[model samples]
Target: MLLALRALLPFSLALLFGCSSTETDTSTEGAAAGIALTETGAHAVTRSKVPFLWREQAYDASLHDSISIITIDQKLAEELTDAERAALGYVTTFIGSECDWDGKANPEFSNLKCKTLSALKLGYQCSIEHLGFLQHWFRNDQEVLIQLASCPRIPFTASSQQTFDEIYLTTQGDTINVWFSASGVNLPMNATWEWTEENIFLAQDDAISLVRTNKSEVIRSELKFDEGL
Candidate 1:
C-alpha cells in the first residue's frame, strides 16, 4: 500500500492543484498583508475563486532510479478535487508532534517528541516537534500560495509517505505557476519515491502542464482541470 501510494506521488502532486486564476494590482497588497500577519505572530487569510476542485494526472517517473508509467486513482482524484472545491480559505498554523533520534540527530528525519520520554534518554534524544497546518479563513479573489509544507509524520499513512512541501505560487500574464520543493529520507521499497532534493512547477492555463526534476530525472505531463464532480 505504501509503495503504491509513493508510486502515485509524482502524478498525485501534479493533479492536486490545476484549476483557475486571478488578476489584480491589489494582489501584491494582499500578499504583503498575509506576510505581515505571519510576522506579527498571526496567520494570514487566503481568498480566491479558483474552486480547489482540481483533478488531473500525468506520467510518473524518476531519473535517479527505476522508472515506470503510473496514473493516479481516478476515484480518489475526484473525491479530493471536490473537497478542495468546497474549501474557500486557508491559513497557516503550527502544532506539536513527536520525533525521536539516535546518535547525531538528523533534523529532517526526526525533531519532535510527542511522547513523555525526555530528550536526554539513555541512548536517544527527543524534543517537541512542531508541525504546520493550513487554517481556512474567509473567501475572496486574491492569489495565494500553497506548498507541500511538511513530510510524512506517520509511516503508516499514504499522505506522509508521498507528499510535497514548500509549495509557492506566482503568475505571469495569463498563466499561474505553482512551484514546490521537497527533501526526505529513503523508505523501504520506495527508492525513486524518496527524493533527496526535488522541485516541481505546475503551469496552469486552458490546460495544465508540469515540469518536475530531482537528483537526475525530469518528468512532464499535460492535464486539464475538471470543475465538476
Candidate 2:
C-alpha cells in the first residue's frame, strides 16, 4: 500500500499544482497579505472551497499505521467539477507534525498527506485517505502535535500516532483555532507548538471533525463556526 501511494504522488503533485496561470502579479495588496507567489510571480492559490470535513480511519497499533480521510456531502460533491474534486482531495493530504519522545531531545518535525482513496465513482463518494506510520515514540509520558491547515501551497509527508495531550478551541476574528497539546515537552528547549486553524471563507455549513484512536477506543470531535474570514 505504501509503495503504491508513493508511485502516485508525483502525478498527484503535478495535477494539483500545474493549473496556475503564468502571468505575473505586481500588486502590492497580495504581498501585504502574506500570499505565496510562484517563481513566475503568479499567486500560488488553491481552488478548494473553505471549510473541509475530516474523517480519521481506524488506527491499528500493531501496524503502527492509520489513515485519515476527508469527504464532502453528496450535495456538495454534485456541484463540483471533476477537476475541483481532485484538487480538494489533493490539498487535504498535507499535515504538520511535532513529536517529543522521552522528554529529553528536541521535538522531531515531519509532514503528512492523504492519498486518493476513492475518487468520484458511481457507488463511491469522492474521498481521499492518508496512510501514516505511527511512531513508536508515542507514550503517555511524551507529547505529540498534529496539524491540518487549509490552503497549503505544497504537500507534506510523515506519519505517526499516539495520544493527544489536550484539545483547544478558540476564535480569532473570523478564523477558528484548534490546538492539541500533550504533557511531555522539555522546558529548556521551548520548542514551538502548532495547531489546526481554518479560514472560513465560504460554505457556512462546512465544518472540521477530529478523530483520535487509541487501541480499541475512539474519540471524535466536530468543530463548526458561523462567520467567514
> By lDDT, who's the top model here?
1
- For model 2, the superposed segments whose C-alpha errors exceed 4 Å read 1-52, 56-79, 86-90, 93-113, 116-193, 196-229
Report the Cα lDDT for candidate 1: 0.27
Candidate 1 lDDT tens digits, 1-229? 7456554443333343222132222233444333211122111222231121122233334423332222222222232221121121121111111222333336564633322112112111111222111112111212221321332233212343333323333332223333333323223333323222322322222222224434533232333333641
TM-score of 1: 0.23
Q: Please write out the lDDT profile of model 2 over residues 1-28, one tens digit for every residue.
A: 5444333322222222222232323233
Alpha-carbon RMSD of each model: 18.0, 20.3
Output the TM-score of candidate 2. Answer: 0.22
Q: Count the backbone clashes (under 3 Å) in each candidate.
A: 16, 7
lDDT of 2 at 100: 18
Model 2: lDDT to the true structure: 0.26
TM-score of each: 0.23, 0.22
